[model samples]
Target: MNIIKVRITVSLIFEKIFGKLLKGHERSIQAKKNIALSFLFKGLSITINIILVPITISYINSNRYGVWLILSSIISWMNLFDVGLGNGLRNKLSQTHAFKQYSRSKVYISSTYAVLLIVSIGIYLLFFLVNQFVNWYAILNVSQASIYNLNEVILLFVGFFCLQFILQVINVVLTAVHATSKVSLISVISQITALIAIYILTLFTKDSLILLVVALSGIPLLVQLIATFWYFSKQYKHLAPSFQLISFSQAKGLLSVGGYFFLLQIGSLVLFETDNIVITQLFGPNEVTSFNIAYKLFSVLVNVFTIVITPFWSAFTDAYTLNDFQWIEKIFKKMYLYWIFTIAVAVILVMISPLLYRLWLGNLAINIPILLSIAMVLYVAGFCWLMIHCYLLNGIGKIRLQLMLYIISTLINIPLAIYLGKIWGTAGVTLSNVFVFLYMDILLFIQCKKILNRNATGIWNM
Candidate 1:
């Protein structure tokens, strides 16, 4: 009788702590599904990326591969030109959906898509013309011989990239509706398609860089475009992006909300995106590859943590709408624990990085110093920590702190990175981010607390 009583007591204790018996909580259930699906898909995406690096390096020479990374970095900035409309729409749609205001959601969706479509068309034309005057060789800091059909490569990539910013709203909508699992499902399929295209190119093509670029950019665009169409046609017919549904009022509203996000985006672009450009300008394209190789290896852990936080972005919004401060408080306590756990994971990742890099890249593996590895680990952990609150801030559309802090960080980041890159090479570039994270982690935590306490006035005001 005593043994049975002890066993029952332990089981009850475990159940209460783990919340297994309390799985009926709506927010928890949504978070659990989102986490599972995101991991499943992001896992596949990460695996494809790991394999792509080696095969792509083999297919294209080192110089060309480095140039491709630069091209990707450049195009990534184009989305920021949306001026934060996509993210604004995400939070807006989440709020409107929670209230069951489906018409407002459709208007927001239609207006944002209309704006992006116009922007995409104009950019496609602008880049097409600008490609003539711009010296790709000088911009990328690559030898002329290393680039074959330079104009064609830029044009094709820009074409796909411009379309991606617009069509990717499908994902924004899915995420807003808290159908994050569906978003992951779409991502996994897109990644698989792109991977298969690259594998085909590797086998059949010789030294055709344009063909490789086409496969990499074009195939994914085709996949995402199709998926976007399929979703709108079937599951989201009401929120479909018809030009007729576009509203100037909704556009103004998105801009009003997205304006801050746009500023934050600019700050982030400077702070984070400039690393490759700085590396290329100072160290060279080959060095950029070395930096990227180490980053990709360790970024796997960061990416996994991101999968956990991403689904919660809109979930936090839903919870906030319901005024469930207790739930938010509990979830945040759990997030803090995970942030601590991430440090241990980062340490483990840095320690094992050597053998992992060698086996993954073999002869092509670059020498990653221990300090650089540690810096990268620090950067990723800090990023994961900030994200725990960043998502909440984004969820509620209150990001003044993010706006001001990121601007300050970006102003400090560039010169600091260049100065450090000169001294420590790649490690210095990674270390520049540590300073940004320090400010972000502290301020965002405070903001989360203030918001939870319902004292979100003054500095915490929208």
Candidate 2:
């Protein structure tokens, strides 16, 4: 009888705590499930990248591997072409869903897809017109012999990237609807397909970066195209993007929000993604590989934190639109504990990273300074901290301050990175971000407090 009573008491307490934590929102509970699924799938996908890195380097000389990384980085620039529609769609959908406005959500979907299709086509045409004028070899710092190879691969990659970008609206829709688990499922399948294709290409093809990129870019396209087809055909057919369904009013609404998002993406790309280019310019292509390897190891924390926070983006939108300050306050308060936990995780990752790097890279591992490792840890730590609040800001559509901070950061990043890179080399490149991004967390934290207190004005409004 004593043991039975103890079990019953424990179960009751667990249920009480969980129910309180969930705050009576079915979306909150569902978001947790989605977060778990995303973590699992992204973990698997990241593993593929980790495994591929060393294999790719060993198979294709470090210089060529660096070129591929740099070129692929450039291709990623094309993603901003959507100009924030993806995230705007997410916020719009979540807000509509919060009020049970399903029809409005469908209109947003149609308008976003229509706009994205036009943007993707414009990008391809624009690239084709300009591709001949740009010296690919000079840009990548590669030999002239590889220029033809680079040209062939870049066109293929960019074409597929545009197609994939348009198709990715399906995912934006899924993410907005808080169907992120399905999004993860699609990502896992796509990564696995890419991995298999890459493996086969390594065995059958020469060390041509073009062939390698084809495998990298093409397989994911097939997967995304198929997922888009299935979702439109069945699951989200009611909201399926049709030419007739596009609305000028809805398009204006999405672009209104999306334009800010576009500028912010450019700011982020300049601040964070340009490091590889900076390193390549200052150090060498070979050093790019070394720097990015350490980055991948430390970036695990950012990726993990991202998986945790992604669900909250749209969830925050739903609660904020509904004016659930109590729930918002409760959730943000809980995230302080998460932020502490992530800082601790960053410390632990830094501590064991040397061994982890050796095990993962074996002979391929270059000697990155312990200091650089620590800096990378701090970089992601600050990044994760900023993201916790940034997502909330994005969700609530209070992005003016966030955008302003990013613009300043972007203007300063290139010069800061170069000046620092000259003095401290690799550590300085990442350290620039650490120093610049501190403003984001500090300012955003204050903004969150002001908004919660319902006294938001001045800089908060600006």
**lDDT tens per residue, model 1, 1-462:** 999999999999988755852485687777777887788889998999999898888888676778888888888888787999988899999899888888888889999988888889999998888888888888888877777578788888888888888889999999998888788888878778878988888788876778887788878888888988898899888788776889988798899998999998998888778889889999888888888888898888888888877878988999989888888888888888887887898899888988888899889746667788889988988888888988999898789878889988978998999899889988998888887789888988888888999987877756
lDDT of 1 at 40: 88
lDDT of 1 at 176: 90
The all-Cα superposition gives candidate 2 an RMSD in Å to the true structure of: 3.1
Model 2, 1-462: lDDT tens digits are 999999999999999867765655686787877876788888987898888887778767788888877877888787898878888788888888777787778788888888888888999999988887788877777777644566667887889888888888888888888888788788878878877877887788767777777677778888888998898789887667767778978888887888899898998898778988998999878878888888988787788888888888888898877788887888788788887898888899889988988899888746777878889988987888888888888888899999999999988999999999999998999899989988888999899889989999987954
Model 1 CA lDDT for position 140: 83
Q: List the residue pairs that clash in candidate 2.
A: none
The lDDT values for all models are 0.85, 0.83
Backbone clash tally (model 2): 0
lDDT against true structure, model 2: 0.83
